[model samples]
Target chain A: MTTEDTPNHRTRVAAERRGKTRAKLLESALLVFAQKGAGAVIDDVIAHAGMARGSFYNYFRTNEELLAAVADEINDELLRAIDPVVLRCDDPAERIACGTRLLLHTVRRFPLYGGFMARLPFPAANSGLLGARFLARDVRLGVATRRFADIGWRVGADMLVGVMLSAACSTAREPLSPAYPDASARAMLRALGLDEVEAARLTALPLPAFELPPSSLLRRAQLLSVGRD
Target chain B: MTTEDTPNHRTRVAAERRGKTRAKLLESALLVFAQKGAGAVIDDVIAHAGMARGSFYNYFRTNEELLAAVADEINDELLRAIDPVVLRCDDPAERIACGTRLLLHTVRRFPLYGGFMARLPFPAANSGLLGARFLARDVRLGVATRRFADIGWRVGADMLVGVMLSAACSTAREPLSPAYPDASARAMLRALGLDEVEAARLTALPLPAFELPPSSLLRRAQLLSVGRD
Candidate 1:
């Protein structure tokens, strides 16, 4: 009945608590799936989250649903972190180069995210993942602008995906040199039809500073891991 | 004992039977691991192989051992299939180009092998797997002979590995253009620092005919799956 205990305040507090519970489930699920591959089950997830089975069922019906949710959050967070940097670059080639470098660096920063990414099946070039959509647009513009040769967009996307997957997988497993991102970008640009000198120049262009956003699942996962240790 | 059941003959027959049983386990393990990821259990493999648990234990004591055995067989089979064609191309750039094309083609021709490959962890550039050893040699020779720029062999290999992994993953999932292999090779050559025209020419060179050896695990796996159908 007191002013501090109004129904509206109570409802808001309940909703906030629900949100925290759901996020805890997702963070734990990402870690479990990353370590166990596709074999991770709901029991393992609930146990990792320190939640009752019924509590987990409230948020997700099955492991696949949980996995999909985790992927969605991670993808959204990555786009948020990366799009600003990508937008700052005017040239399509520079966009691709900086995006590739930033992506590899980001994976290196969050090994858990990289681990899960390494295990996910490679989506087809036109699968319309937001990241792939961005890559496709950049590639098309590059070809149209004659900055890149007229390799089909599918082929161009495949080259970038391949390089990124390889680099990401490596980053997930171990520490790599700081130069790996630039080196990978340089190779990818050449593959996309930029001449050696041009490719080199674009990849060597000063990259903007990038960091995982505070709200990222990966950053939460990293903090959770540190907390556990 | 009767002459027909002489000790030497009995021993030879036992060894042959053991080899066949071991091969059966490997093929089934590959299929199960490919489909289920690392969560596949020994029971799943034995069920797929249609063998008793005791019989399975006779061949592989653990699932990890079985997976490793399968990997070794695949690496050996792939090397046998690829090495001759690679040797036939004397120029280091041609060697790299043709090798890339042939590998993608080989994976497409045997998707079961490709599926397992897509799941297996990507190896380090210096891991010294037989195939990696060959690639390292080609990359080093390419740099030494000035056919490729000094991008450093590890970075050079990473670009190729990334491209080949992406191409092989796609080839496993769906049918691609006959030109896909050469196109991928051309892009890879550019990544390795070949000029556009030269890269295209090397990849377009007449590729020596190649086939999976009849005795390869992939060939056997292909036959086994066909038989199941």
Candidate 2:
């Protein structure tokens, strides 16, 4: 056999195919989940991705595993969108406000991703997750600077999760106004023990443009294939 | 025929028996619901109440209907527990803090009832039920007096909802401290646009002793029946 038919070559090709299929399945699953929540099954994902049902076992063993993977990936996307803008702030309070406002903007702007996020286990309990980690970091910084009142760190994080949950659930019921994110962030800052005027002014501060990572080529190509079919 | 065997007496006795059976079923249903969450079925409830399976249809047509009735009853109990202490305060801010702290106390003190309340629809959306309405009414007063800064009523209500939800969920995970309710209430007031100092002082104010309504005779006796069975 030629070098192209060698076992190593065949294995590498198989691995690449597997990676592509997994990406396709994840993208399709997220889209279905956004529309139908986490209850949509493997069949729903397969129909959405236009894939053979037998092939799904190579990637996710169950809908729950697939959903968890989607939750993990989306949180990464959210962090990527937020970090560039928020990481620049020197003041802890500003960091908290700006970071939160960006999160709200992302949630409002791309609802499907946010909806999945709101369904995950309480964010504070799993602070290692990207969203809560950023918030906890900012809150800790605020306490160090004496900018925030010393509510316990976990309590602070939990409150922020509660606020985001409130915002996410409210937004889902109806589209949020341009001012809603600003108002929501300001409210949480107040809740975190910011002065009313400062919370209001900080919330009103102009937020910079933030963008989530561009959809991967695999995701785009697979979604395109679905569209074509 | 004997006077005791008259048609009216028989009809009255039959109605009373039906009422007692329904009450017995509801109390058993709630206890079962708390132990097993919402999934415990009519059969489970009937067996727990020591009633025939056929009797369930006479009170609740379905398990879901029974669950809704339980939710309604619990909200009423929560309101009865909270309103007297909270409604006595005239200062809107003090009123808000007291009402909510009492709610946190209620939730912390009664785990099974609290757990069921926590699982209801998003607290902000259904704020009229249970503790939220008192919180909302106080917030409205604050807004009217301009004692609170001018965030709209719903946002304030929503933020308080966020705070209470945070407290409820966290308290569920672990017992809250004696000061947890105070600190949590202060945090929400700050979030509601109060100055941090004022919020802190208000939270530290002596709260009236609050008590849940004593269990109705029906409930106590029905529970006693379960214990006997």
Candidate 3:
């Protein structure tokens, strides 16, 4: 019994090391997929990770697993990025306006993520730009605060999603007009039922800055991806 | 010289027959491509046109040329289909609102062209939609009427384009809600700076019925395209 107890500690340390390696591999896969589109080669992912081809096989049974894992993480982290401001803000109108403005600006600012999301070839591509997950929440909050006109939140949400898709697509080509953020946000707010003075004022409120995903993903793309660079 | 002039009439009639055959082949190619997407085969186009493989070569140098011509014609006809309503309307706001609403609804009502348009892989896909030629004119008219809030029509046009993309995508899978046209139009008008009552009234007025492209395209796709069934 005493001899067996010592072996448990050794095994636990080995397991921890293996888990860390798996995480590192997943991170590398995401960076590669972001640089390339969804149709990228599996060998590229392994090479991008700086892992041996054999090691990649040891961690992920198939290329599909790695691709799926990368996609899930990208979407999860993206939605999580906006949670702090959109979910916690006290003003519902701010929740809708600022949240939308932040999302549009960020996607353009981060073209690898934003451009890909705009043209996501996934079956859920329409839902991708629609912000289907968070849109209703924003609209409902505006309604509860009486900031928006009494209309279906769904309509407001759909309109905003469409605007985001357009803004993100254009942002990929050029920096947005300095006037875009203000004008677009104002337009959406007015459409949702706010008075002009209020819509303009709310949209003009200083937007809070958002923290982007870790820079390491981008650094890896620029430094390691061969064909993309 | 007199003998040559007498023979000219016989050659001119032969040329007209060849031209008709080429037009028929191009029209069939458009239908099959819309149903099968950009990856469609040349055999399918030849078969759809009711032409022999050799006849197809006479009209098109290669499959790529046929596909490019097909894509160009689809977009051209789609824009032309909207022209009678959009170009001739006396009221700019009506031109903008009705043109947009009808465009959205028609895309939903007609899946072949609408679905393909939503996912066009052309280098010009963005411009394929920006409806840039017509959108700027509509905006200027609204501004001239003092109907819209004084702002750049560019932003309104961008927002409208985004909305059209979303609506077109949705229309591909399921029937659009009957209320969608009215509600969406109202939202856009309000966003553009119209008063609520006016927005509601404009959207509520009986919508003008739109004419879809001739049904020959659909008949060809159903009878000729394979796999899509």
Candidate 4:
């Protein structure tokens, strides 16, 4: 047999195919959840994916499991997309504003992702994933540096997340003013104890370019949304 | 014919029965929406109500109609409960604070209502009903009197509604610290341009007793929740 037909190559090819199938399922699941909220069943997902029931069961056993997997994928992709810019901000307040604006912009760019997020209950949307790590990290830093008032991280994160998620939910339904993200960030900062001037200035700072690799969930959601349509 | 069997008596009895059936359908819809989010179908609602399909169509033609009817009922009940206390407070800032706290308390006391609200997307939660009239009135008064920063009523309403709804959503899933509602209101006031001291003092004012009439939606939801259990 040729080198390409070796057992090692065969196993690698099979694994690659399996990975592709899993990713496709995730993409389809996102679309389904976006359209139907958390109540979507496995049949809906499999139909959206054009896959048989057996193939879906191989990837996810229940709607909850599939939703959990989708949340993880979103966190990972979002973390990747925003980490670079967030890490570059020296001031915790700036990082907070930047993160808020970037998230809103990302949601606006991918209405499907926003729709999925809009349908999520607050706890499901914020718990142990999206807000848990990234926002929590920034909040801790802001508190330690005295950039934020001494409110505990939980309260601080709640204020920021509440405004951002609500705004994101609004954007999902219709186009918001271009100024909405900045205004929302400013309000969050003000709630965190930044003076009006400082809050306005930070939110008004030029946002660095937001880049999502083609492999990102936001990108996949965009493509999948079009394909499903 | 006997007096009880007269045509007018029969007509009045039929109307009362129809009203009772419609109310039962709404309560069931609340439970179904709470459990399944907005994606719940007519079959699920009818099943929850333990009624036949024909009965459901007589009340609501679609899930959207059922949700709309539920929302209107909630708004009417909430307005009645809060209007007395809200009118007693003359200060626009105080009205905002009182409104925020009352909404949270209402949600916490009636988790079925909270769950239904928690499942709602932001626009669906706030648009044309919940935030449209009562909160909008307070916001406009606050803005006109310069109690709130001169942000347009839309932005002002957005800040208040965003924080309140987010807090309500969180309260739906779990019990929060007793201070959560006050803390949320204080942050909202701050976002609306109140000083921290004033914001705190306003929220700390002894909230007037909240009373939902025995016939209120909150009471019905409470009873319905026990019945469903």
Candidate 5:
């Protein structure tokens, strides 16, 4: 009998199910790591996910690898959420405002993942390994930032990143604080050269789902992957 | 001699000596702490200053007190370095630029002390025993920030404080890199509705020292006494 027609096909389907279980394990790792921080142990992750001890090694080689994967996942989600808004708007001020609102919304929705990555205790960016990783990420954002700078937006990409990271960290630490979101949105708008009235108007509007032009998503994905490498 | 003359003479002489020794201990502590974080032992500070252990104790009751005093000294230097330029500039953008340039120069001059205070793992503006002591020194600088905000600068006082602290920390970590200082000054200027060219012009000028206006020194001295209380 053909293998596809045999009863053992159920076993093959079960293996596929196990693959999904492994993905679920990694997702659980991200959630737990975000909530508890990178200092969390494998056992704690497994306990939180209600998974078997033996099953972890089947998915990840070590805790470090798992943490790295978690970082990648969080980075991907962040880009997924905000990149469209950044790329869609041609006006620098409006682009920044939309991006800021989307970022605030994303942080509120996935507080743990966003917060943990924002507070990652990597070495100084000038240090070889850490710096390379940081610069890789910087290059992608620099593309958008340089676009603004070319058209009279004078702030450097580093300040933009620093301000965003600071805002994200503050929001993560005190999500329930009413003042944080308003202050953060206002700060970002001001940084982008929007007047107070305009900034407030932009901030108060509901953020719309941004649609990417043809090939934009693919290019961004490639750039993001390069950053990860 | 009369009893009144005897009392006054002894009191003045003792006060002079006490002030001299206190200044010496503070200088020593700044050097030691910068070289080896706040965790360095009291013996190290005393040895570095070539002072006797007994003399160190006579000046500071504990290491925590010594560190607090060191923080105060650094803050005072920072305030003295930037206040004149900041207060003299009527334009918000010019004020931010001048303030940033003065800060950068101070960090460059005393990289270690700047790094120690900037990256020290203490809360920003706390009210706990140590926090209260630290915040008392910070309040002077905080007032200047509020003044900037009062002049229609878009950045809030807290955000300005955060930016300043972040700039100091980044500069301390990477003094040779121009990215941080340039980005910081630009961000501050942008928040005040000024472009980078104007900000750069103001930052290029030499900064002045902070001196009390007229009789304000008496009030400052009273505030210092209140902090002690």
Candidate 6:
């Protein structure tokens, strides 16, 4: 009876270990997909994650499902990172400044995810798969637009969103040189009808350092290695 | 002696007629090229201009040279059209409004040229042969950017030029529905930091009808007939 129970306990422990492995695979997959793009093959992802090829199918039924999971993971992470900064201030200008800073920081940290986010259009029709990632930013902008409208400025949310998104996309593609963020941020504020003094004040604030994970470097190296092979 | 001098006068008159025909062909080429894009074949342009295939070579040494001429003609025409408007206003906002109104009118009149203008990038590098049609707008925006900078706004002229060029391109492509020019124009004004009340007033003004010359219509009809043949 003791020998039979020991065999069962070993089987249970193996299953638990497999579950943990799958979770780590998914996390690694998100980093890889964000860096290389959603179109990357499952084999590449499995290799990057340091997992067996057979184990990938156990967690993700297909690459499509895996991409969906990545989008969800990124969306949740971005919301958690940005929501607090957006909600920190009552003043609209302050909100914009904080939001801009938070976004820039996030982009710098997760450069690949940042590029993906900027490139993704405002999923108006296909909301099921890609919409989850865009929802937080859209909602935040919608609220900010309302606040601006309430303050007697008849600005359209889509226009503001388009401008900010374009700015962010441009910023993500290039490194933030000394002249860039200050010049670009001031231009954005001026474009939004902020006075010169207000624009200067917002532009003067130092941008924060981005905190990227080691997994990102690992994923990129994996991609380069795979391409070579 | 009178008959001998008459032949000389007649020869001179015939030469002048040939020169005028060449000039007309070049002008028509601009209209056709701007509509069809720079990549348009010589046969298409000849068909549009109601000229024989062989006649095109009489005016232009080659298709490339014709494209260069088209660019030159457009640059001259665009400058002539907008210079007055820019000179009329001292305030940057007012100047921008005047320039916008003029551009809107020009785009409406020659929708094809507007299409060509839309494709050309700002501060066009290859203005001599491949990209001359793009120079006028670049100069116009250069003046506007310098003016804005003179007022102490350190806005990057290139970025603002890109934004305005994008706006112009969109305006040219879409039909003027009730929701269009007003919404887009307002967005443009907001983006440029123009006064809201002033922009609203400008938007309220009636847009004029776009007029085309009889020869232009005749040429278009002839081209259509040839297409059916």
Task: Please identify model 3 stretches exceeding 4 Å from their true place.
Answer: A1-73, A90-92, A117-119, A122-124, A130-132, A140-147, A150-154, A215-229, B1-71, B121-125, B130-133, B140-147, B206-209, B215-229
Whose TM-score is greatest here? 1
**Residue B104 lDDT in candidate 1:** 73
Which regions of candidate 6 deviate over 4 angstroms?
A1-39, A118-155, A171-173, A178-193, A203-229, B1-144, B147-188, B197-229
For model 4, the superposed segments whose C-alpha errors exceed 4 Å read A28-68, A87-91, A128-132, A140-147, A150-153, A206-209, A223-229, B28-71, B83-91, B121-123, B128-133, B140-146, B150-155, B223-229
DockQ for all models, in order? 0.40, 0.35, 0.34, 0.33, 0.11, 0.07
lDDT of 2 by residue, B1-229 (tens): 8978999999999999998887777778766765564346788889989988887887888776776677666666667767777778789998888888787776666555544444443422144544466877788889989988777776677667766666665654567777677777877787777887788899888778765545642245334545765
Residue-level lDDT of model 1, residues A117-187, one tens digit each, is 66554442113332444677899889889888777666787778777766666656676677777887888
10 residues in a row with least lDDT, candidate 2 chain A: A121-130
**TM-score for each prediction?**
0.84, 0.76, 0.71, 0.81, 0.52, 0.47
Arranged by TM-score with the best first, the candidates are 1, 4, 2, 3, 5, 6
TM-score, candidate number 3: 0.71
lDDT of 6 by residue, A165-211 (tens): 33434444564444544555454455455655676797686644433
lDDT of 1 by residue, B62-162 (tens): 77678768878777776777877788878988888878877777766766765666555444211333243467679888888888877777677766776
Candidate 4 structure quality by residue, lDDT tens digits, A66-169? 77687778878787778778889888889888988888777667778767777665556666444325777888898898888766666666666666666656
Cα RMSD for predicted model 2: 5.3
Q: Per DockQ, what order, best first?
A: 1, 2, 3, 4, 5, 6
Go through the candidates in order and give each one's C-alpha lDDT. Answer: 0.75, 0.69, 0.65, 0.76, 0.51, 0.49
- Greater-lDDT candidate between 4 and 6: 4
lDDT of 3 by residue, B113-159 (tens): 54554444312344556233466678777876787887667678778
Best by lDDT: 4
Residue-level lDDT of model 5, residues B134-209, one tens digit each, is: 2222333433555322222212433454455444455455563544455555555555544446545655565565
lDDT (Cα, 0-100) at A22 in candidate 4: 89
Displacement of the residue A18 alpha carbon in candidate 6, Å:
5.9
* Candidate 3 per-residue lDDT over residues A1-229, each given as its tens digit: 5754788877997898888777677666656555564446668877866778887877788765665555465555656777676776777777777777777666545555544444343223444442435766778877767778866665666677777767766654566776777788888888888889989888788877676555434333324444455
True lDDT of residue B57, candidate 4: 84
